[model samples]
Target: MERKQHGTGEVVFNAINYTVFILYTLICVFPFYYLFINTISSNELTGLGLITFYPKGIHLSNYIQVLKLKGLPRAALVSLARTVIGTAATVFASAFLGYLFTKKEMWGRKFWYRFVVITMYFNAGILPWFITMMNLGLTNNFLAYILPYIVQPFYIILIKTYVESIPQSLQESAQLDGAGYFTIFFRIVFPLITPILATVAVFSAVNQWNSFTDTLFLMTDSKYYTLQFVLYRYLNEATALASIIKSSQGPVNMNLQNMQTPTSVRMTVSMIVVTPILLVYPYFQRYFVKGIMIGAVKG
Candidate 1:
């Protein structure tokens, strides 16, 4: 290979570009690093909010204490269920409906599609929505998380734009082969839209995973609590009330005083909440970039 030489101007420009990118990367990653060091640091130091760059005291006790918190396991399970079920439901519903919109035989497609878009931009206030959820029996129910988000108009629009990019002849030929819309969609369309599907699935899963307000408002029962709500309550409420919150449904003797400092505990919870998405992101990173690029140019 030939050694390439850059002019003075090009060398200076490349140096500036690398410097900017390095700074941007550190800006994005430092908070997470701080959280990690603080979480594993001595509980007392963490509580005092003294941990800044590196851990002063390091041990696994903070994590152990957090894991021992009552009702935490159940709340985690609920969050997992919500993320998986909600993402699947949202992706399938949006893709199928979006595919239907691409069909010529669908009646009043424009108006119907517009109706979904309208709902995305407008909502009856919280009180009315709460009353509606009550009527639908979603209050205090696990279904509340999965049901309300099963059909997302923004995802549908993105999927619709994606579906429109596929050649019509392929679908027409499949129809001529006596295949129905469902078969064509599942066999011909779904496979080609993996990038967009991954993109939407990530979005749906993240939304469901981080959701806490829904639980706070709709879930009065302790059994219906989700992990995010548990974290939120811990961060905002006093530790003295932990025993009360943990056993709100029934009588139980418990002690939470020995739990790590609030900051350490908060860091632990942040790690717990964020770890799943971090683990899953690499698998979708390729699809995410591709989807955004294609959707931006075509959709």
Candidate 2:
């Protein structure tokens, strides 16, 4: 009787746990699902707020139409380029600096490490930062996207702590074998720090992909606009976007049911901005917890 009771309790506990997690998952996923359904459903109905839960009158025209918008393709390319380049640069800087900070032989090692870490505590304000960028000739330049993000204090700290967890004996062995610091770092240290580096890459990539504020301040040229900034413009200028869509399609194909509405444009653009990060996140998620725990907690 007691065994049966214990089994029953265990089943009940598992059931409650699963139920709670399922509800939480639904809460987290519902907004994305809602947006996706609205974008695919009849734009007319979606505009009226009738399409909820399951998609109705499903069509992919929203995505097709959104892709057709002016400057979207160019903005997408710019975003992709920055994400790839920025993530690579940030990871390299973090890893190299992390390794360098660990070496006691480097002059002013402690001072420099603390100097980098202290930047996290404060910002110099936007006007000063903009002036600095302007002075450096980075305003409206592609380097504006990549340069300032390279030496992130938080990422550097994570990498530095992670590197400290590595065995110094390994580096010493490489030194004794006549391998220089660069050789040891590239061949040994870089490979060994994959997990933490991957974590930092994900961070940098997300920052690069989602950033638009820098563009708002630094870029006066439309050619340099990023996808996120374009989305921002689209949202803020919905009427203009609608007019553009109509002008593109012309009067002949202007069917009321199939026509893209401002709501649809907003939701669709939001999904476009969010989709890349969602797709890329799963690839790096497995390393996220492991890297954060080891890098954060170990040291």
Candidate 3:
């Protein structure tokens, strides 16, 4: 009887846990779901605020319109290229620095570690950074987007923690076999910490992909604008129905002529920008989870 009672309690607890989990997940995902549904919904239905859980009418016209705008596609491509290259470079650099920091014998190790950590809290604010970029001639260039954030302190710390957790015995054994630091790091340490590397790569990629503020401040050329900046410009320039009707030559139903609602545009832009990340997220999610677990356990 006690065994059966315990089993029943376990089932009940699991049921409640799953219910809560599903509810929380839905809460988190509903905004994106709404954005997607509203983006593809017909402008007429969207103006009525009729789109909630599902789209009332389907139309790809908004996407077509947005794509037709100048500089958007180019900006997207630029952003994509920057994200791939920047993530790769940043990951490699972080891993190297992380490995170095894990070794106690490295010269000026304490100072270097402290300097890296200090950067996380103390940033040279935007104006100074902009001035520095100008002096360096990085303004209006692709490097403007990629150079400033190449080395992230938080990511380095995470990688260092994961690297330190790697059993010293493995490295010692490799050294006994006449292997150098480079060989051990590349062959043994890197492979063992693939999970953390993936996690950091995903994080860096996402940051670079969604980046806009730096581009806005640093990029003077239209060609260098990122997707987010282009989208922001579009949002700012989107015409209202009243403005359109005033410019029209013929009489129009001003009341019935709906405004170009920014809500749908915002949603569409968000969906477009976020689609790649969502697609790539699942592949690296396991790595992030595994990395976190390993770090937490061994840290």
Best by TM-score: 2
What does the lDDT read for residue 113 in candidate 3?
94
What Cα-based lDDT does every candidate model obtain? 0.83, 0.91, 0.80
Where does model 2 exceed 4 Å of error? 1-14
Candidates in descending TM-score order: 2, 1, 3
Alpha carbon deviation, residue 123, candidate 1 (Å): 0.9
Evaluate model 2: give its TM-score.
Answer: 0.93
Pairs clashing within candidate 2: none
lDDT of 1: 0.83
The better candidate by lDDT, 1 or 2, is 2
By summed lDDT, the worst window of 10 consecutive residues in model 3 runs over 249-258
Cα lDDT of candidate 3 equals 0.80
- Which scores better on TM-score, 2 or 3? 2
| Candidate 1 per-residue C-alpha lDDT over 103-169 given as tens digits, one digit per residue, 9 for 90 to 100 | 8789998999999999988999999989999999999899999899988999999898888888899
TM-score of each: 0.89, 0.93, 0.89
- Clashes (backbone N, CA, C under 3 Å), per candidate, total 1, 0, 0
Off by over 4 Å in 3: 1-6, 240-261
lDDT (0-100) at residue 61 of candidate 3? 57
